[model samples]
Target chain A: MTLALPAAEAARELVEPVLREAVARLDPLTARVARYHFGWADSDDRPCAGGGKALRPTLAVLSGRAAGADVERCLPAAAAVELVHAFSLLHDDVMDDDPVRRHRPAAWTVFGRSHALLCGNALLTLAGELLLEQETPGCAAAARALNEAALSLMAGQALDLEFQGRDDVTREECLRMSRCKTASLLACACSIGVTAAGGPASLAGSLAAFGAEAGLAFQLADDLLGIWGSTEATGKPVLADLRTRKKSLPVVAALTGPTAAGRRLAELLARPEPLAESDLHDAARLVEEAGGRAWAEAETGRRLDAATRHLDEADLPADVRAEFLHLARFIATRDH
Target chain B: MTLALPAAEAARELVEPVLREAVARLDPLTARVARYHFGWADSDDRPCAGGGKALRPTLAVLSGRAAGADVERCLPAAAAVELVHAFSLLHDDVMDDDPVRRHRPAAWTVFGRSHALLCGNALLTLAGELLLEQETPGCAAAARALNEAALSLMAGQALDLEFQGRDDVTREECLRMSRCKTASLLACACSIGVTAAGGPASLAGSLAAFGAEAGLAFQLADDLLGIWGSTEATGKPVLADLRTRKKSLPVVAALTGPTAAGRRLAELLARPEPLAESDLHDAARLVEEAGGRAWAEAETGRRLDAATRHLDEADLPADVRAEFLHLARFIATRDH
Candidate 1:
């Protein structure tokens, strides 16, 4: 999850401390649980090295800079977005019952579901606290945008859960879920910085559009990796999404494709037992043969182009536009 | 439960519509789940008549009026506190794995755990959104106070979960958890109206103190009911908390009481098997004989007195103070 672009790496470095400070404001027990969930600490409360990719925070800071605001002034918005992201991840793991996250046991696995759930709640509240800390002119708008994104994120999660175990899920439904679950937060992340800086709403809208497209591209790439990426690189099992019978972009595409291969893939997926390694491989192959993989790859490229177009239309400073373009490309092409 | 106080009934009528409006602002699916959880809708997604007691919102509106703010201006703050209360109940039911709420199947029981959990998240985010809706001078402060209260509430829930299945939980620990889990939100509900109206901080503090005391008294009464109240009255199984071996205030008091009956009660509670109907009766008898009921009753009276004192210290208008006093008394003595 290394940042390929120097600007992304710089934004990550700039935002990490702010995130740490914001999380530190939680009560001691919640702070400890949150630190563990963020990979900043271990079960024994000892320090750890690993953390998230910081993509949302980086987008926030870069978009702030692109909107003609100082990067330092965007730190709270950056940290706030990251908190919301972390909150979603914590709850998502509980909802998905995922045993692992970030190359380690998931927070729910380590701290129990109750603790993880409450930690998520605390983080969500803390995000609001962070957004209002400075009393800036843009704080109200920023808070509103963040809350709207949060609500959309939860609605997306609910839809995702509803889509599970249903064989009739449409590709359109999957795409909508992806947009709501992933793109909404990313779009907010892109816009929150500008809003926090009191920049023009028009610029914020363009950056949000850019971020939304980039987010879709990122999710499409992720869906591909979930089936095809190496375990070493992705830090997850091979065909992880298929193993859970997740109705992700590729699976939905395969399930609903107009081909005999799609029917066979659905038949294979309908088996009641846990998917064996051989079954996973066969499912992945069937999905690729059904044109799901190709469709996703093409969609990723389309979204990336749309994202670049939005960035260009934003009319940001040349260097900032170039940096955002680099990050968008990096997201579309990243292996993990 | 019926509101015995005219002020409580009036506040409910005022705040219920506001809460419905705030919830309506959520995306359709999330809003459906929220309305269902609040008992405003049935399992078929049609409208229903029953709902919560609206204690938090009532407190908020009354506290605002006591602070000299128009009740209309306090609607958003009132609705926001109710949302927070509903959010806690949704999550708490999941964590407690309780099957009943407001005399019906719990939201998690009816809508499933995932929907309930995500709905709770959406409601919480909606609370912040509602708080920020009016852009009042005290919006930032109101949002801050709400978030802080939410954090404490989660921390208290975390502690409550930790205390489960433990035999060594002290009375002091139980009381602290009660305050965190219940009193914090009540206090926030008391203060948010004043903050939202830009009233004096001192009045807010006094009202919050009053609410906190009343909250503890309410919880104490609830603990007593959990052991002694009939199923018909409490809308729960008889001795429900005892059946779950909850470390509630009365149970903790009985467990730590310096009486021979306390030791006898501890021995009875230590049985590994689930308590039978006869055992529940014995447990209730033992608790009363150990003076747990007497102690809780005395404590509730003390808290009610302290709450009235705080109300007196708040220097509110005479009629408003009388209304608040009536509400507090109703909470402390309610049968359901």
Candidate 2:
């Protein structure tokens, strides 16, 4: 509650230019795709301004600075993390068949799956290329982190997709899925920050601890928003996850819970047809009634607290630790 | 015909260890995927008989050696190119929906699309990582070349995919696609070889020329086998491209040719359902009647000759260009 950190300002200053320079250097075709994803330009190489929040890159650069590293020196690593995040989003939107993104048409809907696929792949390659240009041990270190993060993201997505329509989803499974899908990348981001500073191994451990806790809290907030957050606040329909029959943590908990709503939730899930808006609202109410909402919110708060404690223990500069303090609190509280 | 170039063999020797060493360093999950792609292990992680031709890496290493660079020094660069080729194949199969590859189930099919996708992406990162190591300027150079190749591959694939439904695919378009999908990597191969050798820019130019020619010849053989060869010969069905209505060189040529079968070829392609096996056989016959196979085969021979000539003109030690020489002849003449 007492976040006195300037994470947003620190991130903006650290990342904006590195991203600019990275895209500027791409070949014509790749640059076009890179530019498009960054909201820096359109498909035809014209400039635009709709790219989403540069969250991962910000985490990366800040982590570096927090670890006593020159943020500028680690810009490529930061850029690589951002590129990887963008690429993942591009493909994920397609696979999920989600049409709108960043308040506009998703890449697949606009350029078609073929071009979207290419653009996604190009970002993946471009990220490595960015890391590949770094001096000394940074290139190899960044590449390793990025590779692991990518693999985990894919695996987590696969698990999520696999859980679709399966009523037997366990709490443990959802936790594992969340860890892979969210924590791995955050962990990677923190690791990249550590790499930037050539920080001690403890930095790696500490940042990952912060990242893991933040990641779990972030997912909890996402689930909470799915059911109860405002549409403007979340940029998605309230209870969109329920409408789509997603096996979110709250939903899974409610489905298997011992309450009147729990049995009804199971029956509704069994219905093959798309849920009506009224049905979605009822489902959210049922999940909340089954204590899913309160449980998730409490867990989120606990994790955020843990993350802050880790930041305190990380031995980073007080000012830099303050930034993580703000970010961790923000993660638990964000609507989207 | 007189390749006698020891360069290719030396390059091969240099590449295997570098690649093996890189793979040895992979984290458990990544190592699993890496081994599968390298042909050292199967989808389930069981040992396999062969991995690949290792063509691209060999080209990089050999070109460097032939260009008078130290073969030992260029190992990572060579390995990087090999990784790029493997990465491309993994993604290409997914895009094409090809079920089988490398004498096994396509990586995507075996591992599921999500896992396959990540695996390919991880390999791509590894390729850049291998190149970006501190001791090697070739890392950055290879990264640039590999990225260019990746872009070209995507462009070529897009063009190839787009060409599928269009009856008006031109010879020039097909040729350009070939250059992008095939020649660019090969050209990168040869160019990287020289870069490893610490090139004169002139070395890059000549090597690129050689690569361009060789790559064209390489694809030409593939074009031929796509129509004339059997599954046993090519490990894929003969007339398979036509069956899938792929806008391959032979198919494009037949469409443009002035003949009765050419007209019928267009007519059949216009049909909505997939071409029946019997219909595919007929389509193949019609392409022959339209002189499609002959034209493609002739082009293969011509390009092979040109590739050999480039090596000869480079006037390197007999062994330096030897592998490429053999590879060229093999591409033109192999059953597959």
Over A181-252, each residue of candidate 2 has an lDDT whose tens digit, in order, gives: 888888788768787456777887788788888988888888877778777766666777887788888888
True contacts kept of 2: 0.31
lDDT of 1 at B162: 85
Misplaced by over 4 Å in model 2 are A1-48, A67-74, A134-140, A165-172, A191-194, A197-205, A252-279, A315-318, B1-82, B102-112, B129-144, B190-209, B253-295, B312-317
Q: List, residue by residue over B213-305, the lDDT tens digit for candidate 2.
A: 989988888887877877876677667777778888878888899989899988988899877888988898888899888888888888887
Q: Write the per-residue lDDT of candidate 1 for residues A1-336, one digit (tens) a residue.
A: 667567767877888788788778776778899999888899988998878888888888987887688888898888889999999999999999999888888988888898899889998898888888777658777988999999889988988998885789999999999999999999999888899999999999999999999999999988998989888767788888999998999888988989888999999999888888998899998999999999999999999999988887787888888878888888788774
RMSD of each: 1.6, 4.9
Give the C-alpha miss distance for residue B196 in model 1, angstroms.
Answer: 0.4
Lowest lDDT 10-residue stretch of candidate 2 chain A? A1-10
Model 1 TM-score on a 0 to 1 scale? 0.97
Tens-digit per-residue lDDT, B1-336, candidate 1: 767566667788888888888888776877888889887889889998878787888888887887788889888888888888899999999999999987899999888898899888988888888878777658778888998899889989988988886889999999999999999899998888889989899999999999899999989999988988778768898899889988888888988999888888898889988889988888888888888899999999999999989988888888888877888888889773
The lDDT values for all models are: 0.87, 0.75
